[model samples]
Target: MRRDVTAIVRRRGAGHDGGRPAPRRHRAHGPAIAHSGVAHLLLAVALARGLAWPAVASQAEAASLAFPAAADARVEEERPEANFGADPGLRTDGGGDPEVRSYLRFDVGGVAGRVSRATLRLYVAAGGETADGPQVYRAGNDWREADVTWNDQPAPSGAIVDDAGAIAEEGWLELDVTRVVDGNGVYTFALFPQSGDGANFHAREADYPPQLVVATGDDRGGGPLVSTPTPPPGSGGDGAAIRASVETTPVRHGDDAADDAAVWIHPTDPGRSAIVGTDKLGGLAIYDLAGEELAYYADSTPNNVDLRYNFPVGGERIALVVTSDTDTDSLRAYQVDPATRELDDVTVRPIDVGIGVAGLCMYVSPVSGRYFAFVGDSSGTVQQWELFDDGTGKVDAAKVRTLSVGSTTEGCVADDGTGDLYVAEEDVGIWRYGAEPEAGGERTEVDAVGGGHLTADVEGLAIYYGGDGGGYLLASSQGSDEFVVYERRGGNAYVTTFSVTAGAVDGVSHTDGLDVTNAALGVAFPNGLFVAQDDRNGDDNQNFKLVPWDDIARAASPPLAVDTGWDPRRVGG
Candidate 1:
């Protein structure tokens, strides 16, 4: 017999403590274990430091207690290698007959205090209920919906948390997941059928997607746990998946060779702009606006690269490109020739960094007219070095400031317009600091993983410049194959998220690093260009994909600004 599990979340102001806290229940189906590691430890430390959750009103506060699915997909045994991430229906079946299973993930990071009750609700599709219902088990939260397949789906962890009996009709199915969902974080669940008869539910891409209802408890009572359906932010149509119009030639080295990229705007000809990319196994590869490789320089593992324009070197203005060399733990500098679109190695001497460099970005100070290179390593240590022209007309650097985070960090970018430095601590989130040397070690968190927008292992970061300090900060949500956009000014409010899907070129996935520009680069990309390292490029070696910023801007709900007037060359001036 199926157990009645309909839980109602009463608002605190209604004079109810949401009833006594529900008794702890767990169906011992698997080994009793919990997720651990450095990331979770950091989360514990963050909470201990009193990093407050979203404010809940003390009185009659109306807040959202229901959260939509963060990610959802199904894997079918018959098509083991194929991915059905775009499908609107999630399927599940067992007992052979082309077995299938559905995965669902929710970001419950907003829930605070003690969890009184949590329910997982799914909208059953018409004629979708089967003779045998499915069992739910806790699963890993790292899988992405866009590319997950039966061959690569995350394995179910722990034992069955709950199960349901045969449903006579199709409407809504609720499963008790309170045992796995304790407080605030990401939770993933997998459902597999008990019999050969399959069942279907609406996926996040379709109408009436899965929802998570959570009720938190305090002494006064529990807050409102409204079951009202509110679409998660940036949950739009195919328009959010922009297509790539151009792709750079695959790198000479294979297997994760291409790491990071930077765009160089032509001072005189916008059409002649170039892209500077780091080939970790090879060296540096320079490509023109059409994705044609102009030159290649062989070096030992160049992890990341960034460029600044109108730099005074050798008594003349030059476009400076800087890369962090992991092999030598040093800095590699290059000068971009506007006419030939080729890079000339301009390193005067070995500017050695004590730690291995994992990420690098160039910053031109608006206050001092000085150029700085921000380099970070795997240990979360970030060092700021001031770049100067040696008497020999080559580049030299002096370390000025050092900063630290809690975990591994790779991608980073410095805004020449606002003098702000943003760093991506892979498993943590994005951190913002003042670019000025004397700015000290104080920093602010722009966003964090499990906050509902970003997944773990956050990668690259790029800023889209707009007029009047209006722009967006874009970060690579590597775990989800999407990018989270936030307003560049003020509080860094979240704008939207978009993905690079297949179009004229293949889509981009597992992107390591990326860059953007607001300067119109000829007819090919009038509103500027976005370049990213694509880890999955069909059959060939890894390469970088290019998309026009205008397409992405117009595809957003309110439409992001397509400002071509923000000159990259004038940012430092």
Candidate 2:
């Protein structure tokens, strides 16, 4: 005899609030009395037709209880026959071999719940007759398992599984499900195997195919959300208001494509600035602040050059010098008319002092108004040159001194306010020379700002005077796709370190040239620009980019917040 878990009440009479008990049926089995209400109903109806009670009861019970709802209840099951094969097209051999593929799918209804445990079991034929075993994978939302096991052993956790062992008749691999919390809906499944040797594995299209199951559970609340923090106030303080711009000057025998540039603001007329840029095969192309080509000189090969503000005999004017790595591989100087923005009618002369003449910096003394140029060679020797006016447009050069640097000297910069010069060696890092720009001078090696942060090819250097009386050192890490900045301490030591992706004007693609403008110049620069050049642009020559100083200052200050609650699954696969 079987009884229903829920009790049933019947209405007694008309307008009655309570119900009377329904009629009960009983039957006699071998030494046992069974209460069979459903059976009795069938028996009474059968008797009216002249049928026997025992026979009618037996037939009704057998017909009604053959299938139960509990027996069909959904339970997680593994389908070993649905294993995946390999692809033949990927194989090098002409013989078309198969591969391994696996998948998992299940529905958790629409309600949300934490997954307690999940597993997949794969059955393989013993004797290694099959090409490969089956691999398992999971596909769903908000479901994660920490330690997945295959054949009762821990499987690799991070990377997706691709290969499996050969399938043997008696050796079946069972994957243990660790945890899963699925929402309601239909899900799909897959199982693939990788080829063991050089054989190609192809998956049969009609294998396990795809299936969906339903999940039955109540919805739980959502998980916690995370976000990045906002930067602090006053992080980017009032930085120096330096600005600058570049114009292509036309010189005889020179291409209009300018490669490098230097700027000199008129001491008398600060509004009028003199710009000198290289014409590659030609001489120097001179321009005014308004981008007007004023004068050109056909003397030196203008590979790369800089302008010294006011030199001896120039008197409030500036001296222009360029590195001629193509011709004599020497540093050459020319005089410029500050008022007219023209090359002074002075004879040009070469300074034969620097070791690496390919890379040179012409720096003017802020206090004494004297001029000196530092030249770098391929052998990593830096030579200093002092300009002596010869009453003509050309000034005679004297060998100041030479300093031994690392191999491949690249970028050099001199701080007018501090009288300290910084040179970046391609492999060795940044080296600092003392106040006097003379040869064999007292030099201190600054701490290599980027140990792991920067890659091998460190290319450019620039300096920004911070509001707090210190300065910021910007270095282009060419290979690493990063531009690193360091805060200057007392001497060669840098106090803090940071980076800016937006300010990465040059190295973003392939940074080559970098320069920082003074406060007076920054104001004239469009939007307080700090300039960098990228030779790796579509063009062979360098193209300049402007970075807002305020953005750089902020990035140098502190870290910003980030959202930690981002889920990659809900967004996509």
Candidate 3:
């Protein structure tokens, strides 16, 4: 016997119907407590399936579709021709009555494009034989529930589409069907016993019905589904990498803490390149290629510095160094004197952060030819500003957006190639957030505290720009005096960890900030260099050390050898 199913067609951006509450399979045969917002349940369901929650800019833009069960039933193997499609409950497995397999079909359609996530929401009827759930397979789409029989039932692929290992037969169980949905059409699934026991799920006609939710994002949609990685702080590290090294005599500031730095590669003479560093207790320090301080700016307490090349200002293509001024709680922009390798405060106008300006980074949007600065505060709030000239020769910036990841945050970096922002939450881990002003607080913790990939108080984030938007993100694992590296593209995935061991000057530890460049500076650093603030250096005060990028890339086990050729000096070209 066959029964009719109450179909509910839901869609993203489609107006929701104020349908009254229906009894749930888990509850005591009655309406269950209602939640606040309808979108809340939908968002939770979408996230669990790894789908994009629609770009806020285009709230109705997420490629999403939901279809109600067209047919669902349990077919018996003993009576091959018998049809149980009208059963209120779906039974699976084999024991006394023999094998009982369940089949469900959803008329999925409407949306097209790459499916990022798909979920099969089912209501378990409970009291089914205590078994380890059943294995789900993509059954042939040619069968109809009303005519489906064991002997003539549609055949299922040998591939295991998904597995529900003993669902707690109480609440609604969501199964990941992202892999099964390669397109829009008759989506059918067969549930068979993985063991001799059984599990029964409520069929479509029951009070609680089955649903198929599919989430997709148009290729034109921005980066909402991209992934990144990070190591947790307060974790133990193993074997280290010993590579080329150079150390600078400690800074003279009290706590002379070296907070952050950026590499300034000379456009013409690569040998004349310099490294700009931040001194928390003091101001800014410019170092020559030889790791010696060339000039010092004592105007404000600078915490972090990042650079962008070919910034069009007054029709002159000049390199700009953007730094967070802790003393004035504002962003200070300096024009890089590429010829003399000195920094001159362009004043461009101070972008106020309202106090406590700690970490800083700059992002250049590939989609929009605009520049944005990300400022992180001690309170963990991150603010983004778009910089542009206000019809004057002076540079000006406007506050665009803000976000947070809890706890103290410092040392941030932006990938111009991917428009992704990396922020380090000292007590937590590094977080990858969309740099787009419209991109909300949907952040991915590239690393965490319990992962042991990073120690607590993770500080500083720098990305080595490899060509074609590929490279590595290096972080200051201050708690363990080591550095953790992750793939720069995708969700920052972990690569390996290494430390500046005691060799020429001393081992680098308790690092505060760091920078990496793929431009060859000199023979000593023929493979580019890594600059890190060393909290503890030789018996001297805190300072920054220079390590050859090659040593870290080839450090094995946890190594990352990347193309050392993304020259920032050629940016905007």
Candidate 4:
């Protein structure tokens, strides 16, 4: 391309040698030089129009774009090696040409923007004509140019970006493809007419190639600030899992039947605490802080046991321990001496379910100050009973309602503050229900039976309480030997999962049940502690392993919350 220019300059003799064109100069350069010259000429014109050239040039690439397309074809039958990408244009909405949809992909080369305008230009070569414009959609890149058939064409997104209207005479039909191309990557688009009038678009091999043009102006490239879930406050990956803060003395249950354990904190002294572990094949053993067996109540088979710090009983408050006794087929409650750290069988008649007991938990209502027990039996049924003072020294419970899982299930927990209960079906995932005494068995599955999140037969469930009804519900993913935690609020969205790897003490695997607390114990558990039954330790029988709650908290990316002020021991005391 060549151009002529004349400079009108007046000399001392006006019009004598003024405004005359010099001899034309021929220069040998490449297209880059010619493009620069053209750009300079445009810059001069823009300058005259009072425009900023740097701003215009920085947005230069956005001013124009061209792309070469590639796609799979009907090689075995039609002209496969012919190398045609998109066929001219698309005829959509039942336009009768085998329902053709042209897929085009191109790159934006990293120019960020909120598209103010976008257009897809396609050359209409031939075919029946219609007035309604074609629609464009983003598509997957699973198809190829040499092997694709109409039958195997990639399915385009159902979302319609630009619904271009009508192609009358069809030389060049432009459809707004703004929504089709946003940032980068081989972006894909599907073109189809709105109606069955049938139209054709020139292929990539045609002289007039398909082009996607997008433009954006002021206040562009702005969007909502999406973020990775932040770990709970005071939780950070600051340290590794240390040696066991304290491990219980080995149990004699030959088959690793140490099912579950709970921590009972003293009212006045935090360090004066007890761990109550169920020797499933034998009985219940209470251990003091040094892992020394303090007391043992053997004979009855206690599969799962839990304890609440304080229970208002018979004119005086006492800590209580409840267990699911398979032998008696009942939920048995006992009074715990907060000072002596001893357990006494407070023989209130056993809440009999008739089915052998499998798992059990206590729910003390933070709302109405009522205490209820959730008992589960091997017959695949769970019942909630409200326990109240019968004007006597004994505590008796009235059955509220019962729900069944239809499968062998064990291990459950009820959040008193939230009135929510979680039951783990051994071979299934954990299910959630309203823990209200009147709330029926309508359960919502928190985690399902798929993915690495949870393995079949989820065994244990625990909750780490935080202030303002915030906390984490931890599930023992027995199948994967990992514990998964979910936000206590909002559909229990997943937080993270971790395995109790080996340290000074052997790692824990095949965990049956676990418990967590945010209340500060001794210095060993500054952020509280998590006690889990280690089905596999050394060559000895299974035992309870104590892991610092802070270690678990710090290990999480978005760490779990550690409210040093929330003390269960002090809650009702």
Could you say which candidate leads in lDDT?
1
How large an RMSD does model 3 have?
Answer: 22.2
Q: After superposition, how far is residue 546 of candidate 1 from its true place, in Å?
A: 0.5
Ranked by lDDT, top first: 1, 3, 4, 2
Q: After superposition, how far is residue 482 of candidate 2 from its true place, in Å?
A: 3.8
1 against 4, candidate with superior lDDT: 1
Question: Relative to the true structure, how large is the alpha-carbon lDDT of every model?
Answer: 0.75, 0.41, 0.69, 0.63
C-alpha RMSD between model 2 and the true structure = 26.6
What TM-score does prediction 3 earn? 0.57
Give Cα distance to truth, residue 68, candidate 4, Å: 65
Q: Which ten residues in a row have the lowest lDDT in candidate 4?
A: 1-10
* Steric overlap count per candidate: 1, 60, 15, 20
In angstroms, give how far residue 402 of model 2 lies from its true place. Answer: 1.1
Which stretches of model 2 miss by more than 4 angstroms?
Answer: 1-259, 267-275, 279-283, 286-299, 314-325, 345-348, 354-356, 364-369, 435-442, 447-453, 466-469, 489-508, 521-528, 539-541, 558-573
Candidate 1 C-alpha lDDT tens digits along 33-134: 121243224322333343422223333432325567878888888789988787777878878577888999887766655553456767566556677678
lDDT of 4 by residue, 403-503 (tens): 98868778899997788999988776888988887778788889876853688768889889888889899888787777888888879987777887654
lDDT of 4: 0.63
Write candidate 3's Cα lDDT for 175-256 as tens digits.
6555446557878888877666677676766644666766654321222321112123432223453422456656778565
Q: Candidate 2 local accuracy as lDDT?
A: 0.41
